[model samples]
Target: MDHMGADPDPDGRTAREQLKSERERDARRRRARRRFSVVGAVVVVAAVIGTVFALGGAAEDEAEGRPLVVPANTVGEQRTSVLYGKADARHTLSVVVDPRCAPCARMEAALGRAMRQLADKGAYRIEYRLATVEDDARGGKGSRWAVNALGAAANEGPEKFVRYLDAVLAGRSGREEWDGDALASPETLLGIAGRVDGLRTPAFDKAVRELTYLPWAKKVAAAHNQNGDEDALPAVTLDGSTVTVLGDDGVPVSPGEFIRQVRGDKG
Candidate 1:
């Protein structure tokens, strides 16, 4: 698989991470030269570097023989994705994201509400593809750990999972950038879970701590690597084609505009 975790940068960063960092620094330099002439350009560029779902124990977790705790109502051979919206909804909007990716956070901060409103209005369903590439890039396990926590939330049903997912992205953290150290902590995961109504149950907390869904999290990352030419994290795809949510000026098109664009672009 052509995963970002493949090639190592000299400083031990993964290729994607290195490239993303370089791009960001370069963008900053260019912005300074242009005297902040085009702030929108950076937003669009940052958005594309945003997603990943990659790793685990002994296959990383494969050799452990722990029972895979699949989320309820998810699809695919590995049961990847958190299924949301009406099954019969006329369209599917696939959103890829990662826990510690700063771009993913900004993407969420920018248009998450619009997407949810559309989903609620039956404009389209959403399949959240959570990635762990950030974990691999940084030699941290927070991405997989976060996904495992998500699995615990999903076990209770989509509503819990959805609320918990949003909370993890922003809930009580009350910040923009992700605190990777906090994400790596099971107690932090539990604390985020506590913000979701009825999600911080004993079983849910146990699963997050013990990583009952670790196997599935790995599967999701593997499948992510094997499947598509990754369009980037925090990406949006409709009818199997990538869609740009923000305009050239870096502003999100209104929810109405988004729907019209998707409808026009449907393959």
Candidate 2:
């Protein structure tokens, strides 16, 4: 109509003004895309960093002559876990957890007995992969300390290790919050170990106090990251497949259902 078509967008702006507005809109969109990309990248990087430092990886774990040691009864080629059940159990149930995660403690409390019974029956071998993300998130060494305690417990024996885990993690459930500072004290773990018969010995006391298995704990924490769920605590997998043992709100399902899920019944 009027040579340049009535200001292009019909907003009454001049052609030049309309062009400038479109340019600005495009720039805003570009910035939004950049922000989304940065956010995605940040999430991945944060997970890696969190896992590393959670187990005291930020500090030197293996100093000059300090060698990496695996716990006595740990399984797998990497030997990064405390194993429960027969070595040739029909199924392998791997649990990824953090000592300070309330949900993790809750899950263990709710289903711990059932888990042990199954392991006793040779239904599955429970591989507990401990993570230390809480130490990084909460700004203390409690998670690392707890993991170290478990490592020492495993060295005593898998039975003792499993007993210690059942006692400590199960006991921590329903607490309002984890006292990282309090747990950082060696006495906390030592106190809990006292409940597990034969768990408290001079060797275990020395290991708990000096973090004898800290490097092994670090490796176990790192090994869990390979699962690629960002080390979400209280997560369970059966023979390498994830099982939904807990609801979205962190409440575990009925013990029967948990067993069924592990047995491959989703319905």
Best by TM-score: 2
TM-score result, candidate 2:
0.72
Worst 10 residues of 2 by lDDT: 56-65
Model 1 per-residue lDDT tens digits across residues 135-173: 777777788888888888888888888778777777322
Clashes by residue pair, model 2: none
Per-residue lDDT for 127-242 in model 2, tens only?
88888887777787777778878999999998898788877775568543445445665787899899999999999998887777777877777776675657467878888888
Relative to the true structure, candidate 1 reaches a TM of 0.69
lDDT of each: 0.75, 0.79
